[model samples]
Target: MLRAAVIGAGHIAKQHLAAIDAAPGVEAVGVCDLSAALAELTAERFGVTAWETDFRRLLADCRPDAVHITTPAATHLAIAKECLEAGSHVFVEKPIATSLEDLERLAAVAESSGRWLVEDHNYLFNDDVQQLLRLHREGRFGDVLHVEVQVDLPLFAPGSRFVDRHAPHPAMREPLGAVSDFLTHLSYLANAFVGPIRSASCQCRRDSPVATGAISEFKALVDAAFGTALLGVSTGGEIDRFRIRVDGSRLSAEVNLFEVGAILTRTRGGPKPLIPIRNMVGRGFSELRNARRSLSRKLSGGPGPYEGLWRLVAEFYARCDRGEAPPVSLDAIREVGRWVDVITHAACDNATVSERQPEAVGP
Candidate 1:
């Protein structure tokens, strides 16, 4: 069994631990956190012998085969670099690093160490999204014309600990605002369907709770090789929700995160037909209960979303074991980071971007 160490005992870390426990050929051997109490509690639950407040000590003593860094964004680069140097594969939470430079450096370290590095972009591993990608690839949506993505969330809610004080604090605020956090997921979708983004224009705003609360909204016209794409994100309002629409000839697919599944509309020169993708069944409280039960199964060592991510992780590890190329190369990730920089710069400047290109559908 490949031994693994989990750093960071926060809410997300629990999910990581659950995933590690469920993942085949892997065992959780160590747990580390800034809080010794938290580490001890998690270790006791997992029945691991190693528990410490210092990650350095855990790395040295445990000598785990892999390390999962779920700590704050600011500390990712340092911890990842250390783990790579120590000859352990690294799996880092999303927004790999704040700056493009740090991302490149980490990539270099992984390359030199002959170890694997995987970013935890959870949406990329979602089964529903993967099905959408397959449909796009199969030309179910003819010659992609335009794309729209919107993700919104209210900051102050009971389960909004994911968007709590740490959210407004410097550590969380500086690395990335709501745009980067949400766009990391959206970027993968845009690239998967519309192809690479050549250029972009965006607008952003921040509000304080006392004064209508801090909010960031952005609209970007992304230039894709095949066509053009659009992405918009807003936070600090209403409950959590997202919608993605891809319009094409003959058929268009719309997916709302608030909804269970995607809707496909087709026009064949005569009439429009609505086709519902029945991948997700049930609705109302039943739907919520089913979702919770599915998640619970995954968390309790059964197969689920985390299993998919673990499979990807295992694929990377397998590549390393065989001395083969990683499934997701560093160059591809760098390309994603470059686009991230572009969108962030545009948002900060509130710039309008336009490019002369092939005629594409848009608002």
Candidate 2:
């Protein structure tokens, strides 16, 4: 079995921990966090005897085949480099690095050290996203032309951590606030469908008092490969929602990433009567099917919402066992980071970001 360890004890890290537990042919050998109590608790719960309050000690003790860096986005580059130097493949959680330059440096380390640096674009493994890929590859959505994405969060949700003023939220303290944490996800999704972003104009604003100078809403207009893309993010919604729409010369499709379903419509000169049938077959069917399965999974003891996380973790270990490169190329990850950095700079009223937190970027 491939040996693995996680180095964070946050909510998201918990997801990774569970995924590692469920992953076949992989043993969670250790866990570490800055918080001693938290690290010990997590280790004990996972049946991992090697728990350390200090990350350096954890590395020295376990030296697992892979180190899952589930820490904050800002710490990714530095922690990942250390793991690589210590002779471990690194699986980092998203927002690879806060800036383009930092991302490039990590790329260099990966090249020089010959260790894989994989970022968790976990959403890419979602069933809906997988289906979207199939449709694209099968030419179901012929000649993709344009794209639209919407990411909304319900900040007012009764127990949301977003409203916790005392909590050290990575998004709230990052260079671009919420934008820093979210743009990577959106940018990568754009690249997956529309290709490299050639040019873009992005805007952000604080829409609520709880935002603490962090932007609560953002919008971007981007010129991508096939055509253009309009992307948006906002808070204080009644419910969380994430949706992406791809318009092609032959057909158009929409996927609700949050709802875990997709819908499609043919645009390439279909008869009026056939349009309704196509809607029933494509749009209505996916929603009904996904909803039923989602409910069933929740009812069962399966990895409920973050099934994609489990799949990605399992695949990362599988690749490690096979001595193969990561599924997402380092170049592709760098390109996505570049897109996010450019968009963040543009959205911040062209004010040069002269500095980031020392811990946020790698050397």
For this target, which candidate reaches the highest TM-score against the unseen true structure?
2
- lDDT string for model 1 (1-363, tens) is 778898888866787777776666778899999898999999898777899899989999999988989887778999999999998988887778787677877888888888888777565555556667777889888888888877876543444543565445323365235556666667766766777677788755555443132445567778877777788776556766677788887567776554335556664443233223232222343456546655666567443544446556666556655667766667667666766766766666667433322223221
Q: Assess every candidate by TM-score.
A: 0.81, 0.91
In the range 1-363, model 2's lDDT, one tens digit per residue, is: 988989998778788888988888999989989998999898888888788877788889997989999888879878888998898988888888776777878878888889999888887787878888788889888888888888888653445565566774677677667666777778887778888777777777776765567677788888776677887887857766888898888888887776656777786457877877877777667778878876787687766647778888888888888998878788788778766866776677544232122234444
What C-alpha lDDT do the candidate models reach, one value each? Answer: 0.70, 0.79
Score residue 223 of candidate 2 by CA lDDT. Answer: 79
Worst 10 residues of 2 by lDDT: 352-361
- For model 1, the superposed segments whose C-alpha errors exceed 4 Å read 156-172, 211-213, 257-259, 269-311, 314-327, 352-363
